[model samples]
Target: MSFEHEKQVCNLFHNSMEIIGRRWTGAILVSLMDGPKRFNEFHNMIPEISSRLLTERLKEIEDYGLVTRTVLSDRPIQVIYALTEKGAELQPILQLIGNWAARWDSKPNIEENTTEKVLNI
Candidate 1:
């Protein structure tokens, strides 16, 4: 490929990595791959993340036009978050990554290891 085409590809990959590489961002996006979710649902899906961090990541993704936030007019005023078309496009890519991890990741049980270490069990 020409140098200019290579540069453009590099830039596109970098920008995508910048968004997905943020802590908890990938997990958040993966959680939403099934459908829309409420704030608490995210917490349930990714229990390791704090509430404030989840809020921040959600706002950041929303700003990037990857997610759409809608406030429901219910009595308690619920808020729902869903992937936009741009974000939905990531589902297959994320699935491919998951497949790769399953096949090659050396520490697939890292979370279990960490928990065992923490509990000294």
Candidate 2:
């Protein structure tokens, strides 16, 4: 491959990692795969994350065009966060990562989680 091609590939890879490699970012993305969620719903999905941090991460992805924040008009305005097409594209990537980790990651207690329980079959 040409040097220019290699350089572009490397740049793309690092850029992708910089966004997705942030702590809790991948988990947050994974949590959104099923459908839209509210702020509290995200917190429930990732209980370890602080509300402030979750807000920050959501804003970051939204800026990246990966997530969309929609405010609904109601008695009390409700805000919903959903993955954009770009964000939805991460689902398969996450699944591949999970499959790889399941094979090689050394966390034996992983099976204690609910997903592992269901995946055990």
Candidate 3:
């Protein structure tokens, strides 16, 4: 492949990593797995998230092609979000990550810090 094409691929890979690495991306994916839901439904489900941030993350997820957005024609129009097939593919990946995290759960951060200090000296 040409150098320019390789550089473009690397940039795309890094951009994707940055998107999923955000604080709430995982939770947002989990939240959408049940079914398509309206904005208010998501807001209530993920109470810890601020409205602005949730909207931002949802837009990012949409841009990534993992979710679909639909608008309903009704007396009061509604906007709903649903995970596309690609988004659903992350469930097993998330489960594996959860299992990996279980091993480190409740471990002391100070212990790791001290170990790092000792290793450096």
Candidate 4:
């Protein structure tokens, strides 16, 4: 390949990584793959993540136009977060990654892992 093409590919990969490479971002995205969820739901699904960090990552993901935030009308105003068409498009990519990880895992029984159940890998 030409040097210019190689440079463009590298830049594209780096730029995409800048968004997904952040801690907890991938998990957040993967969680939403199933369906829309409230803020508290995200915390519950990803227990290891602190509220502050999840909030930050959610805002960043929303800013990237990957996720949408909706405020619902109810007695206590509810806010729901869901993947945009752009974000939903990442499902196949994430599933592919999950499959790759399963193959490389040293553990003999990946089926028993909670992440496999969560990610539906």
All models: lDDT? 0.85, 0.83, 0.77, 0.89
Clashing pairs in 4: none
The residue ranges of model 1 lying beyond 4 angstroms of the native Cα positions read: 108-121
**All candidates' TM-scores?**
0.84, 0.88, 0.73, 0.85
lDDT by residue for model 3 over 1-121, one digit each (tens)?
Answer: 9999999999998987787778788778777767888999877767889989988999999999889999999869999899999888876766566555544668665354432232221
**Candidate 3: where is the Cα deviation over 4 Å?**
1-13, 107-121
Maximum-lDDT candidate: 4
List the candidates ranked by TM-score, beginning with the highest. Answer: 2, 4, 1, 3
Query: Would you give me the overall lDDT of model 4?
Result: 0.89
Worst 10 residues of 4 by lDDT: 109-118
Writing each residue's lDDT as its tens digit, candidate 1 over 13-87 gives: 999899888999988998888789999999887999999999999999999999999999999999999999999
> Which one wins by TM-score: 1 or 3?
1
Question: Which whole-number lDDT from 0 to 100 does residue 47 have in model 3?
Answer: 84
- Residue 74 in candidate 2 has what lDDT? 83
Q: Write the per-residue lDDT of candidate 4 for residues 59-115, one digit (tens) a residue.
A: 999999999999999969999999999999988888777777767788876675545
Ranking by lDDT: 4, 1, 2, 3
Error of 1 at 48 (Å): 0.6
Deviation from native of the Cα of residue 41 in model 2, angstroms: 0.4
